[model samples]
Target chain A: MSEKPTIEAYLKNIEEGHFKAYKCVDCGMIIAPPSGSCYGCGSSNMKWAEVSGKGKLVSFTVIHVAPDQFAEEAPYYVAIVELAEGTRVSARLLGFDPLKPEQVRLGINLKLDYEKGKSGATYLAFKPA
Target chain B: MPLNNTNIVSAAQTKFGALTGVTLREIFSEAVDKATIHAGIPKKDIQAAFIGSFIPEMLVHQGHTAPLLLDFAGLKGIPATRHEDACASGATALRAAIMAIESGLYDTVLVAGVEKMTSVSTSKVTEALAAAADDQFESSIGLTFPGVFAIAAVAHMQKYGTTEEDMALVAVKAHKNAATNPLAQFQKEITLEKAMTPRYVAWPLKLFDCSPISDGAAALVLTSNEKAKKYTDLPVKITGTGQASASMNLCDRSDLTSFSASVDASRQAYKMAGLKPKDMDFAVVHDCFTIAEIIASEDIGFFKPGEGAKAVRDGITALDGDKPINPMGGLKAVGHPVGATGVKQAVVIYRELIGDAGPNQVANHDTALMHNFGGTGATCVVNIMRRADL
Candidate 1:
């Protein structure tokens, strides 16, 4: 039998221009950037679903010594955002200038964006609301 | 409980920390010379070889280079094999030597680990080290080894209330231990004030809290128990060795306060050696980062979780403490030449067990443990050994 379309595949399909994730069938737990399995239940039987594309800014760090690939965007802000769906994801917390760790605070709404990649890898990002 | 089955008669090492112009073969040759001299054995005695290295492709652009290096080291015809398990390559090499001696396939075996990390740039070194983690899930997320350990530190602090002061104590003690160790990379001691004031490398981790990028090699001359007695009256025996691995991704675990692989491997080693943590007179646990050392102290059952840091602050982990650890400055002070760290730990254990560790030796030390972990605890090896003459 042919394998069913993965949750990541389904989310990437509908996320051609929009950011989205999934919710658990049992505990309503959310998996962000879309995952194939539920961490809560360990079930592969997950479904692609849409989120509010909004989250809370939980924590952040200013990566001054960026990786080689991310060197062009040196000293960028990487933050953990807890979506309205209650799942946390890491991304470049945009719409901020010369970010510092102390500047970030908990319970700040964050918005997600979907972007086409230069290397055929779809990208997801978040920005302060 | 007698691992009189296998013994290491001699050991040697190359100067660690950034050998700028040395070739891999040159490094191996230096190690070979030192081992032969220490063992008082001829080069012709090595009947087999086990070589350990990480990222030779990036550093030297060579694959299957062990046979060539062993040949150049004058062990051309012996069965030489390469062992790579990220940073645990040295312990793996030692394990291979032990197995060979125990199997009666080779009466004398040479186990060496060589890595030329300085041949690459700083960024390249970071990238190469990341290869120890899962590329698809961990590295793809731009998570470097420092970031991985940083996450663990955060989780441990959140769960166990470990403080920055606790982490600083680890660096303090390691530096204190390294100050008296001639072979240590940083032979100067730093006070807790200095360690606490350093520039941050990652959240809750500073530059001094981490092991320096080092280039070096280490080698051990393994002989059957019978042959070891002929070389030295106090050759250390291979009492117990155990290795275990855990999930490659840090996000895949239920708890981050302790390394599951370390706990499991230590349990196995202790059982095999017929001993417990309390039975150990001293130990050298992996301290790639200060927090790693603290967590290791707990995982090895030296302290309760979250209590390791307190123990350090309380002076319980000092060299004069009841359960001294990392008396040779550990990876924090001595430097961690990734592939060479495991064997170096063994060498430290050898020194202490023989009461040859001047100034740093625990009084009356008999049995000791050496714990080495690879890539954020994804792989761990713990060995327990006692004075062979005991």
Candidate 2:
């Protein structure tokens, strides 16, 4: 068992150039972006562990109309990436033209990465590996 | 198996649109007044109030809204509580009122839902609406409601070969139905060309594919079956209701093509009513986005999975079609004032069942279903209502 996985700690790890998810100590199931209880077997016993950051592009959307916070980054790709650990996470999808969604292919391999927003905050992102 | 306990005596709502300069209290009271007056019941008869307002705290800087709106509606000195489950806030409130009546705590109650969204900038409203999603995983990463649905739309398209044209047809149908709905926001029909040409709000979801941000309120008066007889001869009975929730984050869902909570809720509602999808005369489903309605059509079992769009293309969901849906235009053209939407669905169904839907009236109104979900299908509420005489 290690320090409980809080979103703050998860981001802190991301900011430090590491991607970690909660691995249920009981069932060995991975819970990404961290959760107190395991979705697999409903156990709260979990430990922080690093993931391979490898996954496939499951589904995606190009957001032309963004929220106020991300207005400056309009016309960006947001995608659901399934980590090789079998857990899915939503992240910024890069290395593709958002305007031409016809070219973006699903099931493309991707690797976990980080990007900086206009507000100088680091965020979890994914790019074609 | 039907819920013989509670009946809807009356339902009312302000025109769904950008009601500029209209305060929440005024619109809310207006709806309350219309419902009570239509039912011919004095406001004093409402034993308690359950109100729903999704993001007034962000949109209008108002909190503790249950008492504020209730006081303005002359429903003061009664026990009032507010319910919030994102966009399904109103249905949650309605469910609570139903349970309260069933529990014998109160014979008569009022349920209301409202939102004043157009008062703010579009970007601000978008930001406010995004709060409904999981902030850490979804909204915080720049996912808007349109974006969330777009993701689902893409998945549905991929798995079922549902084309963008299939989705555009939904918008066209919504506008056509809305043309005859007096209280709808957009009363003019749109061509498929117009729907297809709109810029992408989120890819696979065009601007026309989305519902507008509006301000409005809807209220319903409910009483036990015995008390309903004192009001109107044509009371609509709420025979079945089911509310269920799923993971707050879309990433947690195993499939993006359909919403599990909707299926679970509708199944529960159908079982309770002792009815099936074929028995429903019509439906008022949450069409927050065009794709949502298509997915909802399947989720409620009206159409098999991946067959909803085909049904739409075949005119099966039109006003005169075999299984009409959103005969009052739905959130698409009716305007989605978030919280008001769920309550408005029931209002539409009640009017249809009572033969008051005017030009949008369908041939059969024996029974209908209303499906409303909050956020990316995280919270879903399904209800079946029928004429009490049935």
Mark the 10 consecutive residues where model 1 chain B has the least summed lDDT.
Answer: B135-144
Off by over 4 Å in 1: A1-62, A72-129
Residue B265 CA error for candidate 1 (Å)? 1.1
lDDT by residue (tens digit), candidate 1, B1-390:
545678877777777777878888888888887888655888888888888887788777888978888888877888888888888888888888887888898898888988888887888888888889866544554556766676677667766778777898898899899889877888898887898884766655677778898888888888887688777888888788889999776645546678999999999888888888889888899999888998999999888777888888888778998888998789888887888888888888888888888988877588889998888688889988777887
Q: In CAPRI terms, where does candidate 2 land?
A: high
Cα lDDT of model 1 by residue, A1-109, tens digit: 1234464564455447565566666666767545567778877665556678887765444555546875555555555567777677655567666334545554578
The best candidate by lDDT is: 2
Docking class of 1: incorrect
What lDDT, from 0 to 1, does candidate 1 have?
0.77
RMSD of each: 4.1, 1.1
Give a tens-digit lDDT track for model 2, residues B118-203: 88898788778888888877787788889999999999999999989999999999999999988999999999999999599999
